[model samples]
Target: MKEYHVTVRRSAPEGGEGYLQEYTVPFPDDEIVSVLNVLEYIYRELDPTLAFFDHAACRQAACGKCMVKVDGAVKLACKEPAHETMLLEPYSTRVVRDLLCES
Candidate 1:
């Protein structure tokens, strides 16, 4: 099972509760992948206790809700395959959660 580390910067559910958390996940194959899928896997199997929420739709690289920074450059999470170690962070527009930048 191939795996990678993802650092997510998510906002706290309440006041002054924002921080970065590292998540280790496994990728089966080099199939079409989305940032939200990775996040969902982590939230479902890896750690279900982490408090992070995201909004994603039309995994066809159209909707910008899944836009994030992978190792620095901003790209659509839904467009990029989750196939490597990535530093996922919020965009420059808004701070909703890890790797979720508003535009």
Candidate 2:
């Protein structure tokens, strides 16, 4: 198994203060996981309070709703690979909470 460091920018709900939180996620060395999978793992297995917008049925990038900033670059979370180390933030907009953007 291999572990990855993921730094996530989180914000409180309804225009509250924001901060950065980091988590170490593990994955099989021979398996590739998407960024969305890592997020789901974090939410399901690590933190239940984490909030973000995702439509699991539409994870193929057909919809533009799952947009987020990964390493300062805007990307569809479902379509990007979960790299060894990642810096994640919500899209530049009014953040509802954590990675959930108001746009």
lDDT per model vs. reference: 0.68, 0.88
Q: Candidate 2: misplaced stretches above 4 Å?
A: 13-15
Candidate 2, residue 12: CA error in Å? 3.3
- List residue ranges in candidate 1 displaced over 4 A: 48-57, 101-103
Backbone collisions counted per model = 2, 0
Candidate 1: worst-modelled 10 consecutive residues by lDDT: 49-58
- Tens-digit lDDT track of model 2 for 1-103: 9898999999855556788999999999998788888899899999988887789789998988888899999899899999899999998777778998887
| Residue 55 lDDT, candidate 1, scale 0-100 | 54
Pairs with steric clashes in candidate 1? 9-98, 91-101
Superposed on all Cα atoms, model 1 deviates from the true structure by an RMSD in Å of 3.0
Q: Could you say which candidate leads in TM-score? A: 2
Give the Cα error of residue 31 in candidate 1, in Å.
Answer: 3.6
- Over 15-94, each residue of candidate 1 has an lDDT whose tens digit, in order, gives 37677788888777655556667877888898776443355447676655666777788777667777477777666646
